[model samples]
Every structure is written in C-alpha cells, then in structure tokens.
Target: MTSARRTAVAAGVLFLITEVSAIAGLALYQPALTDAGYLGGAGADGRVLLGGLCELVLVAAVIGTAVTLYPVIRRRHESLALAHVAGRILEAALIAVGIVSVLSLVTLRQDGAAAGADEGALVAVGQVLVAVHDWTFLLGPSVVLGVNSLVLAYLVYRSELAPRPIAVLGLVGGPLVTASAVAVLFGLYGPAAHAISALPVFAWEVSFAVYLIAKGFKVFPVADRTVTAGGMRPELSVA
Candidate 1:
C-alpha cells in the first residue's frame, strides 16, 4: 500500500482506540455518580480516580493518533495547512483540559469530607469542579475536531481517492461535533449538563475510523501539467 493509504489506516485505528478506551473508562467511572446531588465519599472518590486515569489514557491515545497522521494530512492537503495547525492547537488544548479534569477529580478524591463538615459545602465544591470539567472538556475538543472534520470532508469531496462516504461523514459530522460541544459548554440544554460531553465526539471518531479502515487514502489523481501560450507550464486539473 502507498504511504497515504497506510497513514489513513493508522488514523482509523487510532480513532477506534480512542473511542473504545473512552467508553470503557467512562463505564468504569459513571457509577461513581450514583449519589445524585453530591459527589465524593470514599467509594466514589476511588472510582473517580480510576475514571480519571482512564480518561488520561484516552486523551493520550487521541493525541498519539493525531500526531501519527499530521504528516499525512499536511502532504495530502497542503491548502489546509493552517486549518491543520489550528486543529493541532485545539488538540493540545483539549489534552490540557483532560489533564485539568483528571486533576480536579483527584482533588475531589483527596478532599474527602472532614468530620462534621457541612455536606452542603462539599456538594457546592463538587458542583464547581464538575462545571470546570464540563466546560473545558467540551470547548477545546469541539473546535479542534470540528475544524479538522471540515478539512477532511473538503479534501474527500475534492479528491476522488477516498471513498465518498468518508468525506461525507466528515462534512456531516464536523458541524454536529461543534454544535454539540458548544451546547455542552454553554449548558444550552438540561441534558447538556451531563458529563458525557464527548459522546458526539466519540461518534465522529468512530465514523472516521470506519471510513479510513474501509476506504484507505484513495484520492483522485491530480491532472497532468500543460504548457500555456507563453510557454510557461503550470499545474492545473479539470474539475
């Protein structure tokens, strides 16, 4: 297989890994929220720590995947270098957000209630940390993933090389991702208050993975160069 195809395959695998790990970790951690109004008693704190650690792994998986495909994306879509760079910045920001989230979880875990401490005060602190977790987690990844998705979709639409569905997924999934992230960040809907901010993102990642694995990096061949009247040759292709 060509390098581009190989890169696409690798990108797909990374996406798959990220989603799986995220879901698995979340599953392990969600039960910790069993107590509705408040957070962090002894049992809950331990679960939160495990969950946070899982989240860290998930973030690392995503970053690793992006880094692997960065060169491929640059080569394939030179026109989108700026977008790709923006995506990278967003990715870094998202990773930082994940780190903060994990730290917050750790903090809540460490600060287990003191004897006779006001339960209300503890709940308030939990609420605050959860709020921080919600905003950063959504905002960072949404912008980055959304832009990257648009770029990928455009590239797919323009190039005949990749399976049309992969491009189509990029086009459709990108905006949904951005909107969902924004909704979560802004807490637009009551449901948005939930900690599953990354669920839509997980969907997009999974779609990308499927497309890459199934289609590889199949782009339309660039048209041949031709000489103009002035005898100067320029690269041009018929749309």
Candidate 2:
C-alpha cells in the first residue's frame, strides 16, 4: 500500500465516521429536540450530553476528510483543494457552534429546573437554541457541503482520481442540494424537499468513500508523465 493509497483509505474511513456520527447524534438528540418538556424531564441530561459528544466526533471527522484529501487532490488544482479544506473547516466550526448552543440549553435546563424558574422561559430558550442548531445545519451541511462537493467532484473528474460515475454523482448532487437549500431558505419548500435534495449528495459521499477504501484510485497518463488518478507522479503515487 503506497502512502497516497493509505491516505485515501484514511479519508474514506473518516467519511464513514462523519456519516455515522451525524446520524447517531441526530438520533440521540431527537427526544430533546422534539419534546417541549425535555429540559425538565428525567434523563434528559444524559441524552443531551451524549448527543453533544457525538456531534463533537462528527466535527472532527468532517475536518479529517478534508485534511486527508488535500494532498492528493491539490495536485490537480491547488486553489480548489484549499477551498475544499476551508469549506470543511467552516462546516466544522458551524457544527461546533451548534453544539455549544445545545450544551448551553442543557445547562439552562439544569439550572432552571433546580431554581424552580419559569418553565415557559426555559422552553423559550430551548427553542432558540434548537433554532440556532437548525440554521447551522442548513448553512453547514446544505450550503457549505454543496460548494465543497462541487470542488472535490471537479478535481476527481478532471484527474480521474476515482471513477467518473462517482464524480458525476457529486456534480449532479451538489447543485441539487444547493438549490434545495435555497428553496428552504425562501420558504418555498419544507423538510421533505430538503430531504429529497440531500439524497444525491449523500449517495455521492457514501459511494465515493466505499470506492476509495476498496479500490484506492485509478491511474492516468498526463503529458510526458504517468500519474495516479489523483494527479500524483507515478513514483510518488501508490495504490
């Protein structure tokens, strides 16, 4: 296994981690997110804390994918590779902000419950925190994801880093997701619309991750040199 192939595998693993953690975190948070009295309810603390921790892992994994892929993809296009890294970082930061909001809500719930404060006020605060989290989700995964995916897909397509089919998924999905986000922002559609739009990008990432792990990358001849699909010189590239 060459270093570049190893890096590709690592990136794939990180992508899987991000996906699993995001789903699990959201699942763990569902009770608190939906229940009006979760702040004062029994066992809410544990659920919220677990959810927050999962989200933290998700943030790390998100950044990890970008960092691991940077070296491989940058060979084809430095600026776009850097932009993908920056976009992933911004996504992680937004997710972290959302985590903070949730944690703060948890703290408020605990304190308010102990102090016998107004339940209405606690509920209101919780609602605001959830709203903040939702917005971050929109901006981070929806908007930022679109840009990052498009950048990556372009690099992959141009360099034949992975299969063209996988790259095409990203190309198609990125715009769909961004458009869906716009619709949501403008109140033209609901969660169902957003969910439908997210499917393509979701497919792209999952398929790409699997491909990278199982096959690494392809090879191509460029100009006077033979390079790996990711655009690294043949001697430097490994699969």
Candidate 3:
C-alpha cells in the first residue's frame, strides 16, 4: 500500500533472489570446481557458463537489496545506511569478479580443448580461476555480509522496522559469522566448523526476507498534532 511497505517487500524479494542464484550457481559450478579433469573434457563448459550467469543474477540481487533498503535506513541513520550500501556494493563487485574468473576458465577450457593445448596447463589455469572464485566467495558473502547484516540489524532494531527477534538474530549472527570468517582466513576453522558458524547469519537473512515478504514492515506511530489557543508544535515521535 505505502511506498515504504513496497520497498520492504521488494528488498525481501531481492534477498530471496540472491539466495536462489547463489545456490544455483554453486550447484552448476560443481563439475569445474570439483573435477580435476573437467577442463580437459568439453562436456561441462555450458554448465559452468550457466553457473556464471546465475552468479551475475546474484550480483544484481545483492546490490538490489541494499539499494531498496537504503532510503528507509538512511532516514534512521544516514552514515550507517551508506556503510550498508557500500558493503553490499563491495560484495556485488567481488561476486562479479568471481563470475568473470569462472567465465574465463570456461573460455580457457573450450579454446584449450579445441586447439590441442596442454591439458596440464589448462587444468592449472582452471584451478587458479576456481581459487579466485573461492576467495571472492569468502570475502564477499562471508565477511562483507556479516558487516552489512550488523548495520541493517542495528537500524531495524533501533527503529522497530522489523520484529525484535529478527533484529536480534542479525545482532548475534553478524558477529558470529564475521568471527568465523576471520578464523577461516587464519585456518582456525575447518569446512564443517565454518559452515556451522555461518548458519546463524543464514537463519537471520532467511527470517528477515520471509518477514519482510509476509508482513512488509512494522509501522511506527507518529505523533498527531493539534492546534489550540497557545500553539505548541511537537516534533514527530518514533516507535
């Protein structure tokens, strides 16, 4: 109904899109990411390209969520809202880099196979591209998302933009995931532990998206002004 309500729903949809695209991209990338000889064969080039496409969609959606929420959050705190947008932009940029790396790897595979290029060299190059993608995933989604979630959660919590439980999830999840990512950077957490740590943040985002979609936003009440003999104008009240 209201513009603010529409914005919340749109942001939710974008968040959902990000999740879907990220999952689809990763699933489609498995052949090149896991198999050492994937680049040698011509079977899965299309699959990897499709994966790259999904990631491009993900990049768009990632930025969309930030942009959609920017106006609402900026009203509460302009600087932090800017930080949220900046963090999401960085994440999207990193995701774009990863997409490019994968696409280049696909090109390498296709051309190398056709030209009778050295299989060893092609595979090595492919692995390097995959490594680039992995780094981007780590830095972009894991690290940057944590900070973005914190900023968003703080704004929502203070402003009552969403339910308190959802905001609390972000508050707790943000620090946990960020710390987990840092530990992963330092080789302190293995794959399983890292995944476990990321669950909280994932839960936060999922719940946030669902709530925004289902309920839009919790409307805060503003003060009603009245005119009298001695007019005393009051500032708008926030809930």
Candidate 4:
C-alpha cells in the first residue's frame, strides 16, 4: 500500500482504539463492576474515579483519531466520500463522554446525600440536579453511541478497507444500536435491555478493533480512473 493509504489506515486504527476503549473501559467493564454494587462506601467514589480515568483515555483516543486521520482526510478529500461520517462518529464519541460525566455528577450527589455529607443550600440544589442528570444521562449516551456506531459502520462499508464481513458487522451494528437507544428512551432499563442492545455494539466494536490491528491498511484500486482524469473526475491517487 502507498504512504497515504497507510496513513489513512493508521488514523482509522487509532480511531478504532478509542472506540474499543470507550466500549470496553467505560461501557462494558466498568459498568459491570459498578452495577454489581460491590464497592461499598468507596464504591461510589472509587467507581467515579475509575470511570473518569477511563473517560480520559477515551478523550485521548478521540483526539488521536482526529489528528491522525486529518491529514489523510485532507489529502484524499475527493475520494474519502465519508469525511463527514468520521465527524459524526466523533461527535457521538464526545456526546457519549459528556453523558458519562453528567451521570457521574448526578450519582455523586446521591452518594453524598446518602453519606450525610450534604451541606446546606448546596446540598439541596445538588439533589435536584442529581435527578435531572440521572435520567438524562441514562438515555443520552446510549443514543449517542448507537447513532455513531451506525455512522462508523457506514464509513467502514463505504471505505471498503476492511473485510466485507467486518463491514457487514458494522452495518448490522446500526440497527442494534438504534433499537437499544429507543428501548432506553421508552423507559426500558435493567439487564435485559442492556444486554440485548449492548452485546451487538460490543461485538461490532471488538470486530473493528481486530480488523484495524490485524489489517492496519489495505490499498484497493479504484475503478474509473479514466473518468477521474477529467477535471470533474475524482482523484484516486494513494500516498
């Protein structure tokens, strides 16, 4: 593969890392632990801390994808055909993280109240904010992640970089994600909804991670170069 193709693949891989990290560190692993309710007094505080740290990783992963792919995107602007797809996906990533932050703050207040650590006026306000944040937080990230997953899947398929099966996985991920988000919005919660929606998401993400690491970059020749040679033609140069 050419250098530009390599770079694009590299950027994609970086983006994939953040995707996997968010799902693994933030969504699946941490929640599994927290939901178990094993942390006790330290549970709330410790969970938040760990969650925050995981989010930082997510941020870094996002920034990494943006920066890494930016140059590649610029160079291949005519051919990428899905730059906006990446942008939408990134937006979803940020929203997912923001939702997590809001949820943590809400839970923090609740924890504080439980601990009798409430101050005067601040505590009362905190309690109110806690409820608002909690419910909103519950649904926001799910929807955001689901929407973005579909977008990413589209990008993957359109780009045609990875194997066809992986792209299919990405495509299937979209509806699964959408269903999960809708379920949550419609007052669905608990393990059943979580598992049904989340398993597909997790599967898609893990598959993407595997493809990025294993394949890295694959340069596929675009047809219709003759048409591309015309002024109106799409540029198909690699590297």
Candidate 5:
C-alpha cells in the first residue's frame, strides 16, 4: 500500500484503540468511582489501577490519531491541521489528568485506611476526585472532541478525503456534542442526555475510520505528491 493508505490504516487503528481503551478504563473504574465503601475498605482496588493503565493507553491513542493524520491533513489546510493536532494533544492531556485523579483515589484509599483517617472524609474526598475525573471527561471528550471532530470533518469535506455525506454527520454532530456539553456543565442536562447527543459524532468517526481503513482515501488529484514535514511535497523523481 502507499504511504497515504498506510497512514489511514494506522489512524483507524488508533481511533479504535482510543474508543476501546476509554470504555474499558471507565468500566474498570466503577469499583472506585461508584462504590463509596471501596476507598474505606482495607486495600486499594486493583481494577482502578488497571483502569488508569487503560486510560494511559487512551491518552496515547488520542494523540496518535492527531499526529498520524497530520501530514495528510496539513496538505489540505495547514493552520486548521495544526489546530486539530493541538486540540487532540489538549484532550489527551485532560484525559491524563482524569487518570491521575482516579489513581489518586486509589492512593487515598490505601493511605487513608492505613493511617486511620475518617471514613466519611475519605469517601467525600473520593467523590471529589471522581467529580474531577467527570469534569475532565466533559471537557476533553465532549467539548474538545466535538470541536476537533468538526475541524477534521471540515478538512475531510474540503479535501474529499472521504465521502461528503460522512463528513456531514460530523458537521452536525460536533455542535450537538458541544452544546450538550455546555448544557451538562450548567446542569441543564444530564450525562445520559449528553451521551445521546454524542451518538452522531460517534457514528461519523466510526464510519470515517472504517472507510479510511477499507477504501483508503478517495481518488484525488494529489496522488503524485507525498507528505513532508509540515505539508505535502511533489514526489521526487529520479531521472
């Protein structure tokens, strides 16, 4: 396969990893995030620690998706491509912070129990940490993801990298997700409502990823060129 095709496959894999690891991490965190008695118990929950590892993977994959697509995307629009990369990096950083918050809960559990700290206070602190993680989730995955998704969809639409119909899904989805995030932030909507709003964006991403992996980029005029440091350059021909 050509370099562009290779980049597509790599990006698809990273997007898949980003979603899978995020779900796994969140599910694994339940024992710590949900169970109030967990932190007050004798020892730290291993699942929470494992969740942290999964989120670390998520962080890596999030950034990977941005950087992997940067060269191809920059060829179409350089400034927006830079914004996409920066946004993903910021999103990944927020995810890392959320991971740290969850992991700190585990630490609080172990040390608090060992030190004979008040159980009520410990649980309250755990709740605060979980809340921090939840806020980061709202900001990173909901708001930031939405903005970045919109930017990418616009790029793809303009470049004809994928079908315009698929890009439309993102065009619509991004604002919905962001608006829902704002609503949730202000208590106008719940997380469940936000999840429903996010479905379109999810559909857009999944469809895009699958298309890129299977069909590669659509037939375009730029096939003679190749990616370079910040943009694409014409292929060097050896005479």
Candidate 6:
C-alpha cells in the first residue's frame, strides 16, 4: 500500500478502536455511577480501574484518528483540517479530565471506606465526580464531535476522499448531535437524548471506517493534481 492508503487504513482502525473502547469504558463505569457505595466496595475497584484504562485507550485512539488523517485532508482544506486536529485533541483532553475525576472518586471511596468516614459525604463526593464526567461527555462527544464531524464531512464531500453518501451522513448527523446536546444542557430532555443524537454520527464513523479500510479513497482532483494512494501528483489513476 502507498503511504496515503496506509495512513487511511490506520485512521480507520483507530476510529473503530475509539468507538469500541469508549463504549466498553462507559459500560464498565456504569456500575459505579449507579451504585452509591461502589467506591467503598472492594469488588468494584477492579472494574473501576479497568474502566479508567479503557478510557485512556479511547483517548489515545481519538487523537490518533485526527493525526493520521491530517496530512491527507489538509491538502483539500488547510484550515478545516487543522480544526479537526485541534478539536479531537481538545476532546481527548476533556476525556482525560473526566478520567481523572472518576479515578479520584475511586480513591476517595477506598480511603473513606477504610477510615470509617461518613457514608453520606463519600456519596456526595462521588456524585460530584460523576457530574464532572457528565459535563465532559456533553462537551466532548456531543458538542465538539458535532463541530468536528461537520468540518470533516465538508472536507470529504468537497475532496471526494470518501463517498458522497458518507459525507452526507456527517453533515446531517453533526447538527443533530449538537442540537441534542444543547437540549440536554437546557433541560429540554434528559441524557437519553445522547443516544438518539449519537446514532447518525456513530453510523457515519463506522461506515466511513469500513469504506476507508476496504476501498480506500476515491480518485478525485485537487487543484491541478489528482489525489491517490501515492499522494497528490500531477496525474494519477485510482489505486
């Protein structure tokens, strides 16, 4: 495979990893969020730690997708390409902060349980940490993802890096996700809105990933050159 195709495949794999790891991490963390005494429970420690590790992997994958795609997309639109890199990095940073909050909550629970601390205070702290996580989820995946998807979709649509259908999905999904987040923020709806809003973007990413891995980028003209597996050149055929 040429360098550009290799990068595309790597980005696709990273995108898949980010989605799967995020889901897994959230699943592992759900028990702690639901259980008031999870921090004090000895059995829950392993799950929490594992969940934190999964989230860390998710963060790395999230940033990796952006970095891997930067060179290819930048040729089409420099500003939007840079925005995607910045947005993904910021999203990963927010995710890291959320991870810290949860890990700290776990530590607090363990220490508090051992020290015979007040259960009410421990639960309160846990609640605060959970809230921190919720906000980060809203801002990072909900709000920031909307902006990132739209920018990426536009680039793909214009450059034909991927299929037009895939680009359209991003265009439509980005705003829906963003609107859902705003509604949740204003109490127009509850957290369930996230699931509803996330579906389109999720579909877009999965489909896009599959396309990149199986078919690679479509041949398209960029300025006076054609983009192919070999990178931009004066003339090239689809590879």
Each candidate: RMSD: 4.4, 4.4, 3.5, 5.5, 4.5, 4.4
Residues 151-235 of candidate 6: C-alpha lDDT, one tens digit per residue: 9988889888898999999999998898899899999989876788899999999999989898877754344576789898764
What is the alpha-carbon RMSD of candidate 1 to the true structure?
Answer: 4.4
Question: How accurate locally, in lDDT, is each candidate?
Answer: 0.62, 0.85, 0.85, 0.54, 0.88, 0.86
Report the lDDT of model 6 for residue 227: 77
lDDT of 1: 0.62
Candidate 5 Cα deviation (angstroms), residue 172: 1.1
Minimum summed lDDT over a 10-residue window in model 5 is located at: 230-239
- What's the residue-level lDDT of 125 in candidate 6? 85
Model 1, range 1-239, lDDT digits (tens) per residue? 87667877888887787677666665665544335543445545566667777767777766766576665544446658456655755765665665565456445545655444576776776667666654665565565677676676676566544566656766776777777666655757644443354454455567667877888756523435677888855453433
The candidate scoring highest on lDDT is 5
Our tally of clashes for model 6 stands at 0
- lDDT value, residue 190 of candidate 4: 60
Which residue runs does candidate 6 get wrong by more than 4 Å?
220-239
Per-residue alpha-carbon lDDT of candidate 4 for residues 1-239, written as tens digits (9 for 90 to 100): 76655655666576666665566545533442334332223345555556556656766665565455444333344334355446445654554555464455546556655777635643455445444444433444455556656655565565555676776775776667667667666777664666576666667766766666567645443433444444565555642
TM-score of each: 0.72, 0.90, 0.91, 0.63, 0.90, 0.91
* C-alpha RMSD of candidate 3: 3.5
What's the CA error at residue 54 for candidate 6, in Å? 0.9
lDDT of 5 by residue, 64-139 (tens): 9999988787777789999999999999999999999999998898889889999889988888999999999999
| Worst 10-residue lDDT window, candidate 4 | 32-41
